[model samples]
Target: MKNSPTAGYHTKSAVLFVVFNRPETTKRVFEAIRIAQPKRLYIVADGPRRDYPGDVEQCKQTRQILSLIDWDCEVKTLLREENAGCKNGVSSAINWFFEQEEEGIILEDDCLPANSFFKFCDTLLEKYRYDTRIRHITGCNLQFGKKWGDASYYFSNRTHVWGWASWRRVWNDYDVNLTKYDGTEVKAQLKNIYNDDFVADAWTNIFNELKAGKINSWAYPLDFCNFFNNGLVIIPNENLVTNIGFKAGATHTVDEESSYANIPLIEIGEITDPVFFVPQKQADLSIINRDFNIEQRRVKHNAWHRKLKRWIKSKLK
Candidate 1:
């Protein structure tokens, strides 16, 4: 297995990098991967949007940065010719990743990982390759200064996909369309898991909107996929990834000023395996509550913000 979470260690598992029209962020994230120096690098890029005038140029620039691979790595690319947006673009990229790799690390243009994040996943991915209960190994920890146990990691029901690793076994059952489980019943699932009515209802509404085509996200389905299979996600005690794309152009994380934006990256120390395999119910509840509050406020505020912008533009016209 790869050495403990330390600097200057090469990553063993294949790394999948997903990019779109953000060359600046993509380059930064790519530099981190370059340091890790994974033996195999798989990149997937979504096509430029026809509606967005500069999307073609930006997408081209982002894809161009990917060809700067200088290490002795086997690199593969899946560049789309048509726009697939957030839902399809990302989920399909992951699907493409698993089609060749049994398991690997996945990062987006925005999810910048600490150098140790690669070893953290590489070691655990090998340790639990056959463990069905552990479906996810993610670098995202949203506890925000809260401590759960003495272990270096804790289990959570929430699937934080910012920078994560998973197996094909888990992805094989994934459905971005939520075809298996009825999206209307997500309230009950959340209620049972979190035991918080407000959190459950909030997530249920989000899932409902996602089903109704009002939203575009590949994460909720991934969460549901693990939830459906009674799988638990491994969250490191140290938050290893700092999401840097919480800007105006980002699809969900549009509020760059939000508290969750660009959280300080913390490299994990010696791994302390948690004794129990049960999900941290309290952590899950805290996550749902925090996420719900932030998302609800953002949605409400953004709606009004857009309307005001449109009104101002109409007056100017």
Candidate 2:
């Protein structure tokens, strides 16, 4: 539980890297990956959209950036010829990656992970490889307290979309059809997915978008699908990865709103005890409470409170 080095640090497995048209961020992410030195790497680059004026050039640049991986690993590329956007691009790429491998570590374009993050994933993958209840291994945690172990990895009801890992068997149950919720069993499951009244409206909007075909492609539903079946997500106590695509040109992250930027840096450590899945009830409760509080706090507090928090962090820094 102390800050000891992770066991089997030398053993590396396949890592699926998903990228869009951001060449600079992609370069930085690859640098982090190179240091981790995975044995097999799967690169998925989204193609350019025909309507976008500069998409062709940007897509070419993204591909060229991916070509710069200097590691001696078995590398495979899933470069799309047409733009699939975030929904389709991420979904198809992840589906394709899981189809080939039993398990893999998944990273996005802007998630620059610490070297230790790779170790955490590799260890967890080996630790929970046989546990069917544990559905995901997440690399981001907003609350970076030492209340838990050195890793502080725990099961949560909600899935974090930052950097994460999962097995193919877990992903096989993902259903994109939003209409299935009309059934009796699915409505009961929907209560668990939304967790509470405050966040249910937002989820309803997302589901509506999916139903209306407004979103050409998406993956959050798949994440929700795992949660609906009572899947567990492993989250790091320390904030090992930083997302860097809040600026313009980011497809989905255009909102200027910021929340709790203080992420603690934790050193990855070995697990003396074998990893086990957290009980289903506890996992679901943690997810429900955590998700509800986070959304409620952000919405209830005004801009002045956010600025005050920012100022406090600045002073502390």
Give the number of the best model, judged by TM-score: 1
The 10-residue segment of model 1 with minimum total lDDT is 1-10
* Model 2: CA > 4 A from native: 1-11, 144-151, 178-180, 183-187, 192-195, 200-205, 215-217, 260-265, 271-317
Give the C-alpha miss distance for residue 317 in model 2, angstroms.
60
Please give, for residues 161-279, the per-residue lDDT of candidate 1 as tens digits: 99999999989999998777676567777777766566666777877777787878899888877776788999988889999999897878999788889999988767879999999
lDDT of 2 by residue, 138-175 (tens): 78766535333443565665667677888988878876
* C-alpha positional error of residue 146 in candidate 1 after TM-score superposition, expressed in Å: 1.3
lDDT of each prediction vs. the true structure?
0.87, 0.70
Q: Which residue pairs of candidate 2 clash?
A: 87-217, 87-218, 88-217, 157-287
